[model samples]
Every structure is written in structure tokens, then in C-alpha cells.
Target: MVDRNSPIPIYYQLKLHFKQQMKSGLLQPGDRLPTEMKLCRQLGISRAPVRQALTELAREGFIYRRPGQGTFVAPESAARLSQRTTIRILTYYDVLWMASLEQAVHHWNFSHPEQEVDLTVTMCPRSEFHQVLRRAVAKGEAPDMVPLDYVWITNYARAGYIVPLDTLDALWTRILREDLEPVVAHHNTVDGKLYGLPTQADVTGMWYRRDWFAKEGLTPPETWDAWLALLDHFSSPGMRQRWGHRYAGAFPIGTAAGEATLNLLLPFVWVAGGELLDEKGNLALDTPALRRALRFLQQITLERRAALPPQMASYRWWNICRLLGRGITPMTLGGTYEWPRIREESEWTDEADAVAHLGFVPVPRPSLDAPPVSSLGGTSWVILQQSPAREVCLEILKLVVLPENLAAFCGDGLQISAYRSLNRRLATTPEHPWLAKVIPLLSLARSRPLLSDYPQVSRFLQKMLEQVLWVGAPLEETVRQTAQALALLLEY
Candidate 1:
């Protein structure tokens, strides 16, 4: 309480006093302010000053306004510059993400027992995530943090729904000490600022059936020729007449149109020594390397009739797991994201068969003195420019990103931590049996291109690639046209 007789104006005094209370840890985040009536009676100030201070606080996001409900303390986000009194996070997939967050937040609550942070999850139909995203931004109801993929983020970042995290890396890594992956530091950065922090990362890689490979007396393919030979063995006339290379019934598998379609195709291309865009932002798909890459892709689709299961085209990353979970595709290309979902999820089909049939390996490449390559992909938690609780929001984020905390998100949530230190530890965890192989696989991965107009470039490239494989267009023609379209959208 402050004296009205002080030289400062009544409202000014009140504002300063309340500000001190908040900043001094006397009023932590989510601790509601005294009601106007209570403040008026306590301070012996009239309603005018009390209301003015409350209005000012609400405007500044010190408190939130509700139509019928009283004001509340702001909630948390990446940086809640304006507090999130009520944040509804609409996640499209990755079920484990929230649970990990909840656990982290729970621990945070234990440390700050007086404060509260509420997080609500609404499962937006995966297909409508984009539409809903636009609506949320337009309506000023955007979530504080989200599980965004690589492709849509650049546009969203440009659109202001995502806020840049320019100074969090060192602090964030210290907080997560052992949980963040090495490449994660570089993967989620947009223009040198970290945009998202993944609890886990899953890039495209070859997932083969151990039993199938062993039964056929074949090792994981290493070179392009070896891969083709494996395909040839599976597609041989006698084998085709039988149950597709000794399997009772299973089909060849491939990547689908995912959140980042290029993650699937580009690694294969890069391993073959292709570069999609040059430093000058020029779009050139006419490279011999690109041609060779397409030739390999075409071989997979046309020669072996290798296709993603019909259901996968529309499914988010998890559906590919379902296709794998069934014995329908014994050999597929997926990452750790699908690990939990693929563990014998089928009910009508052979559940035991699927569980035992599943296995993973880095996408084998022809090591013709070419630098090994893969697609680096991950997601991160970003602050919204509009948040009011920016400081506390970061505190909560750091808490969630702790090394011990991050493991639950990765091993439990099926994600990859962005901290290199943590990632190395995760790779060594005996519990994650595949981490040894998975870490090496990640060495060659590069994040999908960072273009200003990524959405348009993505759509155009996806259409051209699909046309090349599904509709029989010439690879050169598809590349030329797609490059032209890309140049129009991305040549900045």
C-alpha cells in the first residue's frame, strides 16, 4: 500500500507499488491481483484510481480480461511478453509432446508453489492445422507454443505467429545440459535465431525388417548398386511369384508427402551430390546430380513399384508408422517419430508379426567419395511476439528443457532434444536401443532449405516430384518446370 499524500499521483504510486510486488518475486506469474473493490478498500483510494491501475495492468498484460469472469494472471508461452491468461495449444500430432511438457511444468510448479501455469491441448484435425493456424493468428488466439514441422514454419515465422529466440541457446543448453541433440542447435534456427526446440528429432531413414534381411542373407545396403540389387532380389520373377521375397504378403515401402516432403527426397539427392539452391538463391534443378537423384527416385517408384501405403499420403508422420506396424511394408523409410506408434499397434492384423518385423537403419547411400548426406529436420517451441509473460515464459521453457527433463520428451514423447549435449547422452542411453545407429545417421542430415516463400516452393516441388513418379512426366521436364516455379517464389 502507498500513501495518497505522497508527491507522486495516486495511480502512479499504485502502479509502482504493484510493479515492485511483481518484480520482487512477491507476485509470481499466475498469481491473480487483488480485485478492484479489495484494492480500493485496502488503499482507501476511490474507484477511479483503482480502475485506472487495473485497466493499465490489463492493457500491459499484467492481468487478463474476461467478458464475464474476473481478470486473471497471464499464463506461459515461449516468451509471454503479454501474459497468456488462457492458452489453448492445438497440436496436430506427436502425442508425447504435451505429457512431457506437463511433467516439466509440474516440476516447475513444485519450485514455485504459489504460482500456477495451465496448459490445455486441443487436437486439431491434422489436415486443418494450417487453416486453423491462420485463423488463430488472425483472431489473436494463437497458442503460446506449438509442435510445428519444418516446412510451414518459415512462412509462419514471416507472418509473425512465431517469435525469434535470439539469445536462448547457451541458457537453454545449460538448462537441458544433457538432452539436446548436437544438430538440433543448428536445425531449428531461422536466420540465426532459434525458432523451435524439439524434445526429439526424427529424420527420414531406411527402416528394414531384421528378420527379412537376415532370412534373405542380405546385409543393409550401402551403395546405390547394392540397394538396387536388394530391390532386384525382392522383385525377381520367382520371388514376385512367391510372397514378395519370402514374406507371406508384404509390399515395398517409401516416403509420403510429409510435413517436410523434401526431407525424404533431398537426402537421397544430396547423397548423390545434388544441391537444390545455391547461395545466391538461384533455383537450378538441371544439375547432373539432381538428374541422377531423380533417376534413383524413379527407379524406386517405377522399377520396384515402391510406394508409400495408400493411407500414408494424407497421414501425418504417424500413419507411416501404422503402415509399418502392419506387415504391409516390411522395409520403409521412417525416423524415430514413428518408433512408439509402430510397436505392434495393429489390432486386426498380426500384432506380434509387426512388432518383431520392425527395425531401423540409416538410409544406405553410395559412398562414391561423396560426403554422406541426410536431411536434418526438427521442431521447436517459439515465443509469440504478443505474449506478455515473456520473462517467466522463458523460465518455464528452460525448466522443461533440462537434460533429465528432456529425455522423457525424447524417449517417452518420441522426439529429439535440440541440445547437442543432451542428444549425445540420449544416443548412449541403453534404453534407446537404436540411438547408436540413429546418431550416425543424423550426421549427414541437413535441414530443409530456408526460403522466405517456403510454402509455395514446397507445394510446387511436391507436385513436380509426384508428377515425375506417379504421372510419368520426364524428370528433366518436371525439374525444369518446378525450378521455374521456385525461382518465381524463392529467388530473393
Candidate 2:
């Protein structure tokens, strides 16, 4: 029976009620369940919660619905519920991870028939993923596992929405931690506990046309002056005509690009020796280094006209990659993850063909002597606290991170592995020669600040960029005001 006053959501309670019925043989396989209206009346609840419960039950394979008919227990529901455990997962539109999870489940079931496990994967759109995930948690419909952005670990952990991986299996967690790259491991840890398992690692940098550079007797830029000179060289009418290029470079510059803008541009702060937070973990945005970085961006986009201002402000996050892939732009501020998309958009035959024409580099520093920097970003699998299948999910995760499985996932996705050993192994292989180039960048990569309010902070940063770069607001004032605004936000 559904308990209205219980802490658990009404819909989830109803879901459990139905599961109990199935387990007790009261609702046998192929038995028709009551209609939504009937369930609502019996439970003395609203229709919405009743529908939500039924929908989730159907999605999880506990029931099947026929159009214009009714819902019935799945034919094999009895066997499945009695024998195998089903692990529910929610992820964004990452087909590689989905395929890897599916393969991992299949291997697990095949190898351990007695403890067979099934998977129910739900995919959400990238744009709406954050909101959808929060809604699911609020509704007590959180899945057993989810692929979360690395930066979001702190938020979820602090909210108690996610379980610490170590709490489930400390020894396995420690081994997994030791196997991961130092930075990757660090990003998934909070309060000295492992909170998630990162599946891949990615670094943000610039993508340029290697073939064009070679043809013109030019080299990849390493400093601000050299970068500016290269942009100027490409912006010329003759150079533009010679290369058939529409723009010298492209990047996201406004809120429309969302977090991509932050990932691509934040490295400039590090290049200028700025940090977003002080040692005390307070807002530290109004620094000279940050000002220098912002001014540099303003000069390139608005003053010198190196890129299309209107387009930069409005571009979707992937637009720069599309431009570079289509040969419309010679250079683009992008990430390692964009390689597959670039290859697809350019219609290249394979990784080798794409590599022969494209070159990737860390965003340029202020001086040639300064070290290059990039923003580290990746997705990690987190088990939800609300899940009843944590142990089963953990076992599946173990299989997912097995060396062969992780390597296959990374290679197929053209992603860098979070494991140091896997990366070292993959780097030397002919099948993933590109790893040899990108794996080194992980050393210079830095993660976004891990704050519970990071999403809000990112939005503020995006608005700051738009105000100065697009709206022509005074740079100093905008920086100062933005910092103050962030301070106020954090205060509450």
C-alpha cells in the first residue's frame, strides 16, 4: 500500500507496492495490472503519481503496456525478478558509454549465469540532462547509476543524492583509485572518499589545420603574440582566398555555448597565473591575470576582428568543430572529444586521415616560456543513494572498468582513458596512435572548480564574457562587478 506521509515519493512507493505484488505471486507473469485510474483510486492518490509509477515499471521491464489496452506483467517478469537483478542507469547522449555498458552487462551475465544482471538505460538530451537528473532525484526515481560530469560530483555528494563508491566496497575502490590517473582520481574524490568512477578523460585545446600550416610554412602558435600574428595572417584577403577560409578561427563566446565556452576559455586564466578561488575557497575572480586574459579575448574578437562576433556569441557549442571540420575555419577552440565529430563532419575516412590534416595544441600561453594549459573534463559513473541495487551496480561497474573494457570504450569513442596504465598501453598501439599525442596533455590539464554552486558560477562567468565581449561593457568594471556578484551568490 502507498503511504502518503512517508519520506519516499508517492510514485516510488507505488512502484514498490507493485513490485511486492509481483514478487509474492499475486501479480503473476502476464497478469494484467489495474489501470492508472484504478490504481489512483485504490491508493487514494493523484493520477500523475500513478502514471509515473506505471511508466517507470514499464521502462524497467517489470511490466509492458499495449496501446488502447492495459499494462501486464512481462512474460518473463517472474523469472527475471526472482533470478537476475536489473541495474537501472541514466545517462546523457553518449552512445559509446551506452554500448560499453551493454557489452559489460552481456559479459557479466555470460560469465556468471547464476548472478545474471540486466540493464535498463535511459538517455536524456545533453541540454536538459542536469535539470532532468535533479527532477528524477526529487521524484525519488533516481537510477542505480548515472554518468555525471566530473565537476558535478561535489554538488551531488553534498546533497546526499549519490553514494560514495568506497562505502560499497572499500578494497575494490582503493584498487580502482590507484589505477586511475592522479588528476582523474582526484576529480572523482570528495571529502577523501571515492564518489564516482571516471570512464574517460578529455582535455580542452585548439584544433588547427596541420595541412594548411605546412603548406604555408607556418607552425602552431605557442605564445599570445604568435597566436595573434597567425590569426592576422589568416585574416588577410589574400590568405583567405588562398585557403578558401571564411574565418581565421572560431570559438564559443556567449551563454548559448554554455559550459563549452567555459571549458575552452578558462585555460586562459591559468596561462595568466590566475585562479578562480583562493586557498580559503572564496571567490577570486577579480585578479590581474584574469583581467589580462579577458582583455586578450576582447581584443581578438572585437578589436581586431579575428572571428565573427555575431556568430561567436550565438554559436552552439559544437559549431566551432563543425566549422573546422568543413574547412570553413582553419582553427577552432575545442577539445579532444571533438575529434570524432570533426572527422564525421569533414567526412574523413578514419582517424589516420583526420590526423594527417588536423593538429591539436593546448591554448597558447602569454609567453613562449610559459607552460601550456588546458581544462580537464570527463564523465564519471555515480551510484545513486536511492537505488536498491547498489551492490549489483558496483559489480557491473567493476566489469565496465576492466582494462580490456575501458580500453575498448576509450578507443571506440576516441577518448583518453582515465587510467594511466591504459593510456600508456593505448598510446603505443597502432590502432590508437592519436593517443600518443593527446595523452601528454593530461599532465597540464586542470579541472573546473569543484563547488556545489558550480553551475551557477559557470552561468555568471558566461554572462561576464557576453557583457564585455559582445555588449562592449567596460572590461574592468564588468570583471569587478562579476566577482562581487559571485561573492554575494556564495554568501547565501
Question: Which window of 10 residues has the lowest lDDT sum in candidate 1?
Answer: 246-255
lDDT of 2 by residue, 1-492 (tens): 876544234555577678778878889888888898888678676565576567657656678998898899987665666676778888765333554566577677768878888666667666677898889999989888888878889988998999999899999999889989998888899999999888888999988999999999999988888888898899899998998888888888888788888888999999998999899988799899999998898778887764553467878656676688778989888889876556535646455866789888999899977778899998888999999988888888888899998887787557899998999998899887677888889999998999999989989999998888777899999999998899899999
Q: What is the TM-score of each candidate against the true structure?
A: 0.71, 0.80
* Global lDDT of model 2: 0.81
Q: Pick the candidate with the highest TM-score.
A: 2
The TM-score obtained by model 2 is 0.80
Tens digit per residue, CA lDDT, model 1, 1-492: 776433233554575577566656676767767787888788775665566556555544456777666766655312332232444567764444554565556566557655656555666554566788778778877767777775556667777677665554456544443344556655565565566656666667777767767776778766777766777676556654544433211222222443445566677777886777777766667789888877876676665554333333333455455555555555666665656455423322222333355555556676656665666666556666666655555677777677677765565434555667766776787666555456556666677766667666666776776677655688887788777767666645
Compared with the true structure, all predictions reach lDDT values of 0.60, 0.81
RMSD of each: 16.0, 11.5
**Clashing pairs for predicted structure model 2, backbone only:** none
RMSD of 2: 11.5
**Count of residue pairs whose backbone atoms collide, per candidate:** 32, 0
With candidate 1 superimposed using the best TM-score fit, by how many Å does residue 56's alpha carbon deviate from the native? 41
